[model samples]
Target: MTQINITRVLKGKYTIMIVLIIGIILYNIMNDENLTFTENIIGRMIYTYSLFRNVVSLTNYEEIEKFRSNDCSIYKNLIFGFSNKNELGIIVEHSIGYGENQEWSILDEYESLEIENIMGNRHWIEIDESGELTDGISMDMNRELHKDEVVVNFIVSKKLLENNNKLKQNLIRPVKCSTKKLCSNLYFDESKVKVVYENDNISTINKDDKAESPGIVIYVHGGGFVFGDMNTYEKVLQKHAIQLGKLNKPSIIVYIGYRKSPKWKYPIPLEDVIASISWIHSNAERLGLNPNKLVVLGDSAGGSLATSSIASCLSIKDQSKRRNNNVLSKRFHNYCKWVDHVKFLGLIYPALCQKCVTNSKLKNYKFGFLTLSSLLWFEKQYQSKYIESYFDWRSQPLLAPANILRKFPKTSIVLMKSDILYDEGRLMYETLLKLKVNAKLRIFSGFHGIYGSSWSSGGSNALEFINSEISEIMNQNN
Candidate 1:
């Protein structure tokens, strides 16, 4: 070979070596620096990456169809949806398994929601029993809708929501506080919210311009605060649609997307969540949904957020109780001042208390899908550094004052036996009862991530319980 040929071969070898080294680093080490690098560098190429994942998921759609209801097919018309991927600063395990034994057990240990997400338009990444990821999805084009469902993709102008609330807070500030300084520091974000309902002879379908819905269920999703988006939880929304249809309560189900943490911390996620509620209440009359009847449902970490949101709502609703507690001063933006409208709260295996380490956590946290290691990591990433204390009720709704807990809307706490978060769910239920806040608690067999899945007998039963609880809440005072 000539000298030029030798130089080119050397260059090729160098390139291969660099690629191999990077891959090794990524495979073994997934710290903040590694993930941030991925988010900033590789994530920008999501348009192409998403295209490949979308193709893979399209193939899985055929197999996952039986598990999905017709109305749940969010990717029936797949559009490149990588832009919709919420970049989490750190990735925590929401249970690929608890430990090595749990991992080696069987494929049955995985939730069907794992396989059910095969049709997720932007989020189809499923870690199989082999611990290999073989799927993904992205969004580069406009979100599409299935023929049978009235799926309306809407944007909550979080920036606008924050500014409007700033004005309100400035208006309501106590005389002691300085008028020159704003009462609440501002957090600006843009959130994607989807409104899904059955297509039952609706005349207009202009995204958010109009909709035909009787009542509404506002859903918040969980991914250990590191992952999860509207796409990942489409099946849960579909489950809601199925139950609502069965109960003859046909309502608009709104799924909201908040920014992931470590990249975006604490109050920002909470802010995005409450803003969705305010948006719904403001537009209920226009959307043809009953403003007086609304329910908020959340899973895992989302349950904590949902609880915090309602706690914020209660703080705003009953200010007399806010006198002594300094945390109560951390009011959420005028989140749907129609607090009376939120009829109920549904929490599925929620992480309610940041400080509690119950018997269940001691036993199941090490061997469950939601492992104790992941929970500690999640709290570290998800909690706000700016806050005065880590255990504040902002994230730990279980710690909210007794008076506020007393005023909480009717709530249903659903749990799974042998799950890490079970005891806390029970704790919340018992506390609610102590406070005389109309609360119901149910425990089913199996582990976390089962309530929204259809794989195991336990998952099916848990899902049924959730459906029934939500249905009862929707029907109450109707």
Candidate 2:
């Protein structure tokens, strides 16, 4: 080759290396708060080397058919430089925010692959090969593209996941089933908290109870996209745990203080329940429980979570990517760790479909905060993140249980007379029965959130009502 041509080639290579190095350095410095300016600069260099290695050394797929032929799922990725079939790690390529890529480089980066939009403009990557990662772009008119954001998700192989000690430990943690009566002054280290994986982690206040004893039902409380915590269900969980203990055949009850919304949504909370169920099983011996003799319960928003969590476990294949022909082989790791088997499922007055229920709720409460607040917020942040189809009831099935009725665990549907969510629970119950899933329908005569209130603080007869159904399920399961 001519000298000029060689010089041009070398320069292009040098430029790519420089940009990668800068990107890595900036990322590290951005994360390091403890570093002085100069120290940060030094740390930046240290960070740049690792980042450079990841970008330059990773696998590349430029051909469309080759990429399409590989096994690819949101949950699988190949390990960098580890050619051995057994040693790949989960690596993801994602661009931030909501929108189509303004930069052409990303198009070139993901060329030849099909992208399928799932929820709210979030697209799933599809390649010819099951798990192929490509450096080229393909034009897919059928796919929905968000305005500025794009992400390619894939889990590393089991071997790679295991080798990364930090990642493995980070994903799973010990469950603490507190026997101590919860009060306003309850102390917990939220930082030290980790998601449980085995049933052994479930602790009950009444651990000495017998095997045939009634099962304690735990509810994971829910708030809209944002709002609520363990405190939301504090009275509900405590009242029943205490009541079950009083029955001598004292049952064990547990509630998840899961990480919450906007920041941690969807998969994070779902994973938390999976971990909690595992913990309940692991601690069954200590907690004097029968793993099979249990009922998982939730109300409203939590019901959606409980149902989704169950669906996540029952399906062996990745339901999210099941439609895409190119994603099967490349998807290595299963996102769900285990199926949470419970004797009964309980959903009381739940906002199962946000699009359906929210519109109705907005109509009646006419003058409230949500309408004005969302409008004001939208006025300020009205960037068309994605010029795509507007979300409606049919578009977002993940938020509703209408699609996942088959294989549903035995369930009891509870609702109050005046609550807005009453219709939803009733509809869901009807659907479950239509699908031939073993389910029961019950209507408690009360207002929304006011089960049978006594004169005591935070008193609600809902606990007594729910416990009765739980006892029947336990008895039947036994």
Q: Write model 1 residue lDDT over 1-478, tens digit each, in one string.
A: 6446643542343433443344345434432221233222222222222232222232333333322332122221111122221211111111000111011111111112243322112122334697654432222211221111111222222221121222212212222212112212211121122223222232222333222345667778776665565556655555555455435444546676665554445655665577556655655654445788788888898998898888866666555234536333323324436566788888989988755788877763222235665567667656654343223465678888898889888899888765789888898999999999899887765556556544335545666776676677666666
lDDT of 1 at 469: 69
How much is the lDDT of residue 401 in candidate 1?
A: 85
Cα lDDT for residue 478, candidate 2: 50
Among all candidates shown, the one with the greatest TM-score: 1
Candidate 2 regions exceeding 4 Å error are 1-216, 247-249, 286-288, 317-340, 357-403, 451-459
Question: Which consecutive 10 residues in model 1 have the weakest lDDT in total?
Answer: 88-97
Off by over 4 Å in 1: 1-213, 320-333, 365-368, 387-391
Write down the TM-score for model 2.
0.47
What does the lDDT read for residue 189 in candidate 2? 17
**Per-residue lDDT over 1-478 for candidate 2, one digit per residue giving the tens place of the 0 to 100 score:** 6456643532344534553466455745464332234333333432333232321222322322222222111001110111232222322211112223111111111112233332232222334575552223344422333221211111223332322333323223332433222111221211133232222322233422222423445565554423344323333444455444434233545565443332233433444454455444544443334555666777655666676556644442344246466353211122232244466787766556544544334433111012223322211221121313333221122333444556677887776543455556777787888889898876654434433233211114455667777756655635
